[model samples]
Target: MVELSKARGSYVDPAPARVTVETWARDWLRSQSQLKPTTLVGYESALSKHIIPRWGRRSLSDIGYAEIQHWISDLSKNLAPQTVRNIYAVFSLVFSFAVRDGRLVRNPAEGIQLPRRIKAKRGYLTHAQVHRLADECGDSRTLVLFLAYTGLRWGEAAARRQRQSIPALRSLFMLSV
Candidate 1:
């Protein structure tokens, strides 16, 4: 019992280090004020559909590279490449927060291999097709023609106001036959 008495002065209680993944994840989600509404919704979806169901109850210290790699491999068999990547990104973010808050020494989600997303081939419209599209659009013929000719994205076209006129738009419409 003499050794116990000798060590008593040096035996300071270590800081509480047993935070569950769910607790940290909730806190992390709550703290993300800068994220856009759509992005926030996506993050929540990923957590609920994938990460939280698998690892939410585990402590941060209990997770490791092997466990994460295995989980990702299992996910890849059924989920799409992009979906798996999105879910992994959410998991990585929670671990990153843990590291920043001193709950973890490093992010376990880092450096894991993920399936590459395949790009779909884009189809280009011919002049005839553009004219046909404009004709089919009826009342929005000008808008359709403008979009087809200029290749403006849907959001960009939707945001354009008539009051803020582009001088080049008028010139572009004078198509020489």
Candidate 2:
């Protein structure tokens, strides 16, 4: 058999050099400094406080979906649902960066099913109830009246003058029943 050293062109192993997930994440974090100050700070904080301690040292190529799921499950222990979702967002962004930079063939976070968000319950008032409330309310209740009628916020109404309009907000309020 040919000597191992003679078979390869260099003294180093012929296998592709390994880049760990942590290193790739760090490199991505460094790239964030060029973004908005608040954005860079947010990314850096997420990386240091959340992503690094959990996933920093693992080999990028070896981090499969199971590991990611377990990490999310672990996060669920102490974090609120929205906070966990934010963690998922950071992971997705990092993996997307890895894919764009050619450090990863595919983003492992792409298809990992995140926890479903609990939607707020919306309650509607009947026409009679609305009329009774409006009759009892004064001019100061105009904002709430508008929220019930034209469905505009106090800010939106406050922001409005005769010459200006919010087309999108108008469109949303005017949707067909």
Candidate 3:
């Protein structure tokens, strides 16, 4: 009869666990290709330069509020408020995905406060400039005026049809013109 070695109280595996912040973030980005090209590029840039380096190796479940708070504090010291807020937004996406994937029970980003930034005043077209712009567009005058007045997005405005009535337009779309 061959003798067998006895096992310990509990079986233990020596393999290293694989879940990490970077992997989760990469998966999310890959899943978001439906977003605009510029938006995808922006996300990739933020992840490469900011979000990944700080929290990449951390397991999704291991992160907590205090850890995020410290990171936010440290970021505020070195980055402008707007930039820090953008960085935090990237972290928010990662944590949000973690919760959705069952990797984490809760999102650590939920209660973390972001630094507030004062936005620069926007520059509007002078009356003369607006008139000149409308004239220059010629056939496209209506589209330009519509964009400036109503704030309808470029895609939605471009999709409008000529036969669409004013009442229908008022309800289906608001004309900036």
Which candidate tops TM-score?
Answer: 1
The best-first sequence of candidates by TM-score reads 1, 2, 3
The C-alpha local distance difference test score for the whole of candidate 1 amounts to 0.81
Count of backbone clashes, every candidate in sequence: 0, 0, 1
Question: What C-alpha lDDT values do all the predictions have?
Answer: 0.81, 0.70, 0.74
Candidate topping lDDT: 1
- Could you tell me which residue pairs clash in candidate 1? none
lDDT of 2: 0.70
Runs with alpha carbons beyond 4 Å of true place in candidate 2: 1-23, 29-45, 123-139, 162-177
Candidate 3 Cα deviation (angstroms), residue 79: 1.9
Poorest 10 consecutive residues by lDDT, candidate 3 = 8-17
Q: Residues 1-177, candidate 1, lDDT per residue (tens digit)?
A: 546744774221224336778888989999999999999999999988888889889888788999999999999999999999999999999989977776665788899899889798999888888888877887766677788877888799889876564445655665722
- What is the C-alpha lDDT profile of model 3 across 40-126, one tens digit per residue? 888888899988898888777677899898989899998899888887887898778766665555678888888879788999997
Q: Sorted by lDDT, highest first, which candidate order results? A: 1, 3, 2
- Tally clashes: model 3: 1
